[model samples]
Target: MEGDVWMKGYFRKRGARWSFTLDIGRDEKTGKRKQKTVSGFSTKKEAQAAAADLIAKFEQGQYVEPSKVTVNEFLGDYMSVHYRSSVRPGTLERAEHMLKNHITPAFGHAMMKNLKPLHFQRFYAEKSEAGLSPGTIKGMHTFLVTAMEMAVTWELLPNNPARRAKPPKQQQHTISVWSHEESEMFLQHAKGVSSYYLIFLVALYTGMRKGEILGLRWDDIDFEAKTIYVNQSLTYSLKELRISEPKTKSSKRAILTPVHVLQELKKHRLRQKEIKLKLGTGYDNALAEKYVFTTSKGNFIYPQVLNKALVKLCKELELSPIRFHDLRHTHATMLLSLGVNPKIVSERLGHTSIVITLDTYSHVLPAMQEEMVTNLETAISKIQTVL
Candidate 1:
């Protein structure tokens, strides 16, 4: 092609068949001119139509150069060049973990251009047969879809095959929450470990995520106003702790602190001060970082540490075991059960929308509905008796 004009491909008769040759472009890596040739067309018109279609695709920038790049190679390049710095460290870590453990193992050797929806369907079927949870399979599907989307964007593939594949349907599980009695019993047991009590209390009352609770700084708390400002979260990666922004815009919020919870926090601060004074220079200088929750030596608390502590406490108390996140759910459930407005509960839990709060805690609504019906019946009966 020259000066935005379509180049006419050469045609010839070869062994009673029509043949055509067209120059597409130069090799991206070697900078050599590349051409495509086809033979055995029954008629000249057939060869001409094929050549015209090819030229049109090239002109529209939709022509994908033939490539031997494997899915693994493309995924590695995509993660390194397109994904790594654009997302939070924790998200990047999860993506890398999923790619290494699941996606790369299954499809890495397959040529990028040869991947089809059936290949992905078979992969999902195998995973389902192997008893992988739908959630895990869905995560893998998301990662593959996103990677393939970038591949299409880079013109490494004609289109994203993952988009056409059917991923496993996400299975919703019942949201588990602690009853009032269970919450009280757990807190009673948690008090023995003074270091973790405040953390658990904050999670239970404020519904802050584990990372957000760990990320708290003394300056984020206002004792007189009984408000806690959540602006960041502490994330651990490669055994190093770093502060990151909250998970969503709503996660960056102010939570009204209960008076009793504030008192406990104040006492916890005094205890930390005494410990710091006793340790003197032996204290970890990192404690000066001013995280509200820390190790006995004054280092930032890790999520795993909190989880382990919660697990150990549950085992000791012989209570139903739940993840640390269950405390946040328990808080929302308790609030909604007490006739608290769903919007307020949504804001307290830092949900992006009331729809999420409703969907997540829909199991708790049946009881609320029953209560509403009973109240309506009672009001109507009182009016009828007056009449």
Candidate 2:
């Protein structure tokens, strides 16, 4: 003990065990004196040393009163008081599912103060062993780190146990839109989740150009095949609107459509039908076979009109102004980065050769090259909350 140290603790023994008692401080809420009793030490020296360490923490204002709140109790408070307002509805739902299915069963009953780095580390390792992806473990780690941080702010814990824990590192995955080759920076986080996301989804999910999208016809979509056949493009040639062949022979290929996009397309068709019925004979029902998208009067939606709409929508959302055509580049970049075969991406994008696809999206290929050794595609799938 130091000469200036004023010890406020005592030691005792009960049968084979040694114990120590210390007056830590007063409760901030009740203004009552607080004491701690630590028992089950093998020797008086060990008890004395432990009590001395705790006294230093108490004097330095780093000690927290022991909380009886279990991990479950604190997680409930964290979700209601913090997550409900802090995260989006989808994020909140995912978090709730994680808590109910994965976290609660693991160590939710353990007292908050009793948690240690080893507990979290072991849990993450066990999860990885059970075939849960590193991404899921990383997400869970982030949640706990945030929750434990809040627990410290609320005086429920001395420090964050999760912050000291080590989690498995996952690959860095991000979606961004780049400008024209070797030009300048463009939009970084274009997730296509806005109110007008349906049309944007078509461009981003399929690598179809604005002209190809504008020229889509009811005959081109095969509902049974779940495919969108690209045959013609609405081109403004010689200052005249003309339905011409695609830029290349490969551009007239068929691309498989995602179910989400197909469902949205069906809904869009229904809305279009309702508008046609309202207009009656004023609408050009004849254009239904020639054009899938149109104005209220069933006039064709030109490429420039769609471009203007995209620019205005980006401004309203405070996002970078990307033209309707840029979404095609974004789609190619995302697929290439995901380790999808370049040849397959070329076929979907209607590129004449895989070399052209490579030349255009070469920037996203280096990361995929590394992914080849890691085989991340097989490992990183849907991050299920189920154990």
Candidate 3:
């Protein structure tokens, strides 16, 4: 009875109780003739106020369908808008796989309004129990949290529930590296193997990553200067080698090789020249680009293929088994054991900063404490004599 736009309200005959409701009608700014409505207001003043509020909200672009969005939908939109173009193709593919295989299937259809922190906590527990490593589960949580942050920006949700979710605590673990004896034995075995042996040597000496090594070209090598340029990384897609710029600007620079490594490289270059001459017309066109290393067929050596070769070598040598990547750790460990400054090691490794180098190699350099004490003692002796 309040107004035509108002719907019927509740009233008690004996107690004089009153209830109010609002009737909302949408207004189209243009001539599309579209309209929307919601009803039930008891008082005329209340109805008018509700109408004004709705108009202002709609004008301010505050109206949103709370039920229209699902977790999957939002994640998809966010990936398309924010992440699709920003990451590498491999990275994008991995993200998609993670979302589809682990994240989206579980919560993809869940309504944005109903998601809660406990749901994610349960998810973390389940994933951990299922044998997923803490590091990988942590990555999943990170992706979820980032996606929820986008939700907040979009005003689809009031807050990020994922922020409150407690992920499993990560455990610190160290991987084993080659001892000096083992390292020497491995190098001895690699002698006369091929220029391919030089790959592992460079990895152990320079701490360069496998991708960076595979990406190296003759132009990047300065034999006279005893330096190697690291401006790119090689990746594979659709069964083809693709050379992409390094992941970071810090990764793009020159690193000096040891005198011994330079000598080995000189030998390698000569061997490569002979192979090129022997192949004649059968040599690959790709090999003409001056890549420093390649397969016998003159194709870029894939990282996986190199890893398999390392595994085979490790097995034959009866060495304490480790991943191909552990060679980099071996290099850092040897350097730090010799009391090398962490700053110098970090620069050679092309780490973005010294902190990363220290964090990674600190465990391998436990002798640093003794070295520091010795230096301090020497300094104190000098000071006492001066006094």
Candidate 4:
């Protein structure tokens, strides 16, 4: 015998066991009527207690409907709807690659509700064992956590299992940079033959990011003030270049350039003007937008082009091979080595805080410490002689 009222739940005897069923209202996700049913209870009271617990969970908004949606399905929807518009094109592209190449292969078919912290722990362990860097695994973890948080928001899961999963610890490695002498030599060699000589010089002198340098326009440079305004970054996606605001508020700044660098920039402008005049109406004015640096045809230069040029120049000059980005590091390292205030270097590098600058260049500290001790020893010696 059982009660007919749905809220009160019902119980019936099935041979040797008591069965209970509680209607928990319609599933909002599937638009289907839902219920919680359990069999094999030893007694009617036990069955009734189980039914009451299920009802309490429903009333508390903690009940998650069993969903057939796979992690892949949720991630697909998340990317298309929740994530696409909020991030930069380059970032979005990287996220997609992480999803397709790593995440989707591992957990795509697993049901969202069925995913557990153990599953993710195993995933991280496997990725670590396979020789993937902890930083890359951390990135994948971040993406998964974000997606799962959205699932929690949608009430598809009671909580984000990703929050409980542990990923491998990130390992910090030493950063490499060019010496001042090496940088000067490279710039000299670049000026002799490279069309991107000014771009490389700016990177080394100002520490502007690749995107910021590529986005620079003639108007953003103030010759009178000897400052370059970093307000935008040029990003490439699908073979098309577009200007976007700087990555962070700190990224938008005014950097004072060396007088010699500005003088060279003035020369560069004159050279560009001469080329434009020679091309007449054939110049790609629509693509250039008065950009401070561009291809001979007046199109914005791609990042890959800069990297290839730097590689070729280094090989030709028999210089140590380093990435174009190492130039920015070279700029910061040089400033720190010269006893320039770290805060000033931080601002020039567009870092959010001086702590980031200090941490990133901690390797340079031992040399600075030695110089400080030497200066202190000299001062103390003078005082001792006087005494």
Estimated TM-score for each candidate: 0.84, 0.49, 0.81, 0.84
Per-residue lDDT tens digits for candidate 1, residues 1-387, read 111223555877767788787887789999998778878888888987988888888888778875689988888899889999788887888888887777788888999878999999999999899899889888888878888898888889888899899888987887778998999999988898646988899999989999999889999999988999999999997557889999988899999999989999888888888988899887775664487888888887778988899989999999999998999999999999998999999998899999999999998899999989999999999999999
Q: What is the lDDT of residue 178 in candidate 2?
A: 44
What digit string (tens of lDDT, one per residue) describes model 4 on residues 38-121? 799988788778888777887887887766799999988899898999888888888988888888999899999899999899
> Cα RMSD (Å) per model?
4.5, 18.9, 5.5, 3.9
RMSD of 3: 5.5
Poorly placed runs, candidate 1 (over 4 Å):
1-63, 66-68, 129-131, 285-289, 381-387
Which sections of candidate 2 miss by over 4 Å?
A: 1-6, 25-33, 172-387
What lDDT is obtained when candidate 1 is compared to the true structure? Answer: 0.86
Task: Give candidate 1's error at residue 134 in angstroms.
Answer: 2.9
**Residue-wise C-alpha lDDT for candidate 2, range 107-219, written one tens digit per residue:** 99999989999999999999999999999999999998998999999999988899999899987543347433311122222234333345567887888987788788978
Residue 278, candidate 4: how far off, in angstroms?
0.9
Q: Which residue pairs overlap in candidate 3's backbone?
A: 21-40, 21-41, 22-40, 22-41, 23-39, 24-38
Q: State the displacement of the C-alpha of residue 140, model 4, in Å, after optimal TM-score superposition.
A: 1.7
Clash count per candidate: 0, 0, 6, 0
Better of 3 and 4 by lDDT: 4
